[model samples]
Target: MTQLPGSYESYWMESVAGADHRALAAGLEVDVAVVGGGIAGICTAWELTRAGHSVAVLEADRIAAGVTGYTTAKLSSQHGLIYAQLLKSLGAEGARLYARSQQQAVEYVAEVSVQLGIDCELERVPAYAYAESSDQVEQIQAEAEAAREAGLPASFVTETGLPYPIAGAVRIEDQAQFHPRKYLLALASDMVGRGGHIYERTRVVSLDEGKPCRLTTEGGATVTARDVVVATHYPVFDRAMLFSRLEPSRELVIAASIPGEHDPQGMYITQEQNTRSVRTAPYGTGQRLLIVTGEKFKPGIGDVSRRYEELAAWTRDRFPGASITHRWAAQDNTTTDRLPYVGRFHPGAKHVYVATGFGAWGMSNGVMSGRLITAHITGQELPWSKLYDPTRLHPLREAPSLLKLQASVAKHFVGDRLPASHADSIEDIAPGTGAVVRVEGRRCAVYRDEDGDVQAVSARCTHLGCIVHFNDAERAWECPCHGSRFATDGTVVQGPANRPLEPRRLPTGTEDSDR
Candidate 1:
């Protein structure tokens, strides 16, 4: 897809002031080495520390700068339509256990917030999934029944106060919302205070998942930990075919300082083609609601203009007078059956834990993942362990996901080599637009404004060398392969593309095909 990156609305963490950094150096050891600094890693570290075990968190960048940086940050157990589907796919016991686990996670956040005196805008409200179609209504009705049977407090509704048309909705009460960053920061402080070491900017280069796993960072640092938790959004252990087990989803988020009066009572989502979910928390003295909108499937193939327009329209329709301020987008890891994977890395591999595929509900699932993983490592009998195990059969069939990922790979890999006959310079592009400038047979994405200033990025996609598509609505270049995103100036906004876009070696006048 041509859509690049999403906007960066302030959700959760408020103060993440740290240096641009790297991985560990030399050799080190800890009781547990948590790889990833998002809510899951941070929360796990906190718990491990509280349990009196020495812990170390290794982050590839500043704290809270990954998918955790890009979440809607809704701290609730109302995963949309999950209970009914899980019951059908994994049985009723599995569904009820999953619901209880998520609810306990939500309560855990509130308890942690109160216990730690964190100021992350934690609020209790209802979560809803509005269905605008009769078929979806039937689905939600079954879902509501399943939810109630699973011991969750949920109901079906035909009368939502939304401005849009709807057939019915599934409402789960006492669901919650919060600022993700605040809670994470509070946990990070606790972790550090309890003698847990957090190594910022420490990108893990290699993982040894044998007994007493040895994790090596790029900087030659070897950390020997009894257990390693890979909460790195997508797992670093790709040899297990973990990437195929889950699908990645990208969403655009816009934060508007809307009038508090316009915010409907609770957090809401709909089953429209482009669904809309809303929640509001006090940003300052006045209220600013974070309208998290825009979800395009990963390897976003075609274009995103329609998607952005849909989000903008939703914001305008939902709260007309809202002042649009911080606009951002977040990409999430999703699984085929909608349930996340959280447990050991694989069946045979012990002591190498992973938590991934949280769908769009990272906040709660993340907390649950941390708790479950911590329990697993400690060999404790914890409730809900079976529901989140990594070795569980694909809750749904996997043929479709495997086919989809293979198709994406084929499509992008074959077309990634930049075209030979592309334009030579920024002068070739018109004002208020961009073009894929070709130089010495290498393609670079170039954009020129009304002033004729030029910005260029290598056309080669960072993931698998596929060319990237430039998205104008968000002004970031998106890789059609695996959804890597780059800023117009070649900065890495997202990955599977782990590196920034390469810059041109010469001026725009160089022949694109000369190389």
Candidate 2:
């Protein structure tokens, strides 16, 4: 999920793939062609199947391999600091509808878990949006007021079992959590068995969101469907200018499984800047304590190494007995306002639906999206569609971020063409350090560390042949376009690109081999 190793990394993959019965080739058309197999896609498929519509899901990877598996899996009505902010920006009516939709989604998850006999360890619990200081306590009051106006049982909580001090918390009862992968896996099985098609490793190159949406695949297959759902994490086919309207944020999660455990039975959330949330789930007969969640950082913006260390220290101080088992990071789409984008991709296109920009609480909300969109596509009146309409324009607080991203993408694509050699020379670089070098004919990027060694890698990124920039924080070469990252050792860390940075040896021999 985080594109790195963790405790459940190997076990999680084997377990789900063994049970999933799906094919990879593109076949006949269906009522809906869902582009992603994450929780949103599966849930949508489930809803479509129940509605007696045939749906086909084309996934770039296995189900739950995207942001869905990477999520913190909290099905809470309390999206931290959301309702309060929404009330201020979008008014009481907007806030109330948003809260109702989210809470209803939470209830539906528990309802469906029992209905389908899905043993996802679903459990109801209390959730807190508390402040650590008295000044911040007013935040809880404001939030509670908004929640009440929204017809919810919310209040200020002065007391909590956490060792840390807090002024107050806004408590929302009956929020839930579960193993996300388990639930999605079960849904995938049901989708497959009930005539819904899922294809793994089948990346959608583009989607024409026009009438009778035509989806083109990277492998030269076309699926023409009456309707299409673009649930793929970022929706590469941003025909709706979603990137500007919706921002991408990466979150870090580090979990330690306690040897002996007693679950607190409720999800706890703090109102700090970079929020931290905790919950207890079953690892086996013995319960596992998971201290998850942190806040948003644009891709490759913050220091990556610091992410792990901060969480490690946080766990060490909080639960001394718990031994670390899994540590990972996830990225999710966020909107400027608190609501998610769920409906038609854009007004220009017909019969294409999408559910994206879920903030970080997609387990319940995403499932609700699947249900609502499927209903609308099949010509049914879903109760919440008007409120969560994808094209609804809220206040443009996110306009700055969106504008900056578009400008950057534009600048990088043009700027990357100039050879890196135009800037630096080998003489300008210290030994054991790397620099872009200009020779008689070509340009190359060279790296050397304190070890008095030299390594050369192609300055051009594999994705679009644009020159790459070395990220000192991650010790990897980062592509300015699309956020592809490669380690200093030339291994691919993240993708859109499946290949590593090209190795450039010295004219005589391989420069890195000397090491």
Candidate 3:
């Protein structure tokens, strides 16, 4: 057996011992019900609780253990080369609003940490968007100018504190990085301390929006709230078909221990080589965790194991002598308009709201979404929320991306169902791995453990009826259409899909074989 490098868990998750909150036991009523215990949901709940509203947080899993825990945790507005694109699409004022919102989000973490006395390892540092190849220098320069115009403290420079030479870079000052799980776990504690209720393993199965939004849990418990915020990373409900406008991509992260002297000294990213983001966190005495992330791809569409290898190779080349200590992946949704949806769920929604599509900048965007949603619920909406209104559509800017996204989704929805796309026999599935196979004229997601036990589940995604593909590296079946992920036993791991993939019986004729 080939051994994988490092611990197969997030460093952020490993570094902290999070609090354990019980699952929802019975029906309850609160001023607000927040679905999801991630940074966004937790932040929103904390804000609402501080605003004198009774709030209950319902989490399908542990708090801060999802995308927020797996994040790179760079709290900066310096999304690689985003200002240039935003300038063209949303104009100068709109871009400034985004910059200001994100910048404020960075400080919000710092301010809140002090206010709550949470030791979250928050450190202010510069952030950079660099160009490696000569051909991309002009783009970096343009981004610098655009970012400056957008009211950020951005400037173009040739030298970044990187190990390698770069053609040019756009540097933004006053950015920060921290242990997101530490910060969010503290926020979760504060929420509970402030009389806000939190429930774990309480997956919201359905939402009925009205004067008092009614949310039903998988455990048969119910939560009634005057308002509800669906900050479940991806909104569980698609009443407005927001799923159609969102594109899901998964990126790999590898962290290694390096000498403190080798620290990058800043958060850095580039558009080259799929994408490369670099930062460091305090690891141990006189050592720092050199975290590198990149190799973005749509979930369930690529060889994820190979992508991890590529990321490792790239990291080793850039930072020699570094010993890899951890490896994990994060899934993010990008909106058609390249901004998050963080406001009223839809135009018609009176008491329901959603916050999603933070792209890869979840730490900053998640905080911003929380604050924005809090403002909306309290009836003091920020002007910047207009940029993220779920109902606001830019037909001219969004049509092309939206159409392309749906086209790919449509292909997977229809094409993966063909018999030719599935394994001909169970023998095609290797031990300790899985594959989609057609058995007894029915499509099934089958996994064969190293112990030789086989299990099968319906291959159709519970979210939109698209076929689910096995992610060998992560050991989860993932929906390519909308990023719904399921465990080997067919239980939901991530969502847009609240229901588990139904278990299926293997036919008598088809059996596992050694071929």
Highest TM-score against the true fold, candidate: 3
lDDT of 1 by residue, 442-495 (tens): 677876655656677788875557777666556677776666777777876655
Model 3: lDDT of residue 428:
78
- Write the residue-wise lDDT of candidate 3 on 92-169 in tens digits: 999999999999999889999999998989999999999899999889999999999999999999997889999999
Q: Over 4 Å off in model 3, which ranges? A: 509-515
Given candidate 1, what's the lDDT at residue 107? 92
Local distance difference test, candidate 3: 0.91
Q: Relative to the true structure, how large is the alpha-carbon lDDT of every model?
A: 0.74, 0.71, 0.91
Worst 10 residues of 3 by lDDT: 506-515
By the lDDT metric, which is better: model 2 or model 3? Answer: 3
- lDDT, residue 40, model 1: 83
Q: After superposition, how far is residue 514 of candidate 2 from its true place, in Å?
A: 4.0
Candidate 1: stretches off by over 4 Å: 1-26, 161-165, 286-290, 295-306, 415-438, 442-463, 487-492, 497-508, 511-515
Residue 471 miss distance in model 2 (angstroms): 7.0
Residue 186 shift from truth in candidate 2, angstroms? 0.7
Steric clash count of candidate 1: 20
Model 2: per-residue Cα lDDT over 321-419, one tens digit each: 666667666767676555788888887767888888787788777888887888778788865687778787744665666667677666766865665
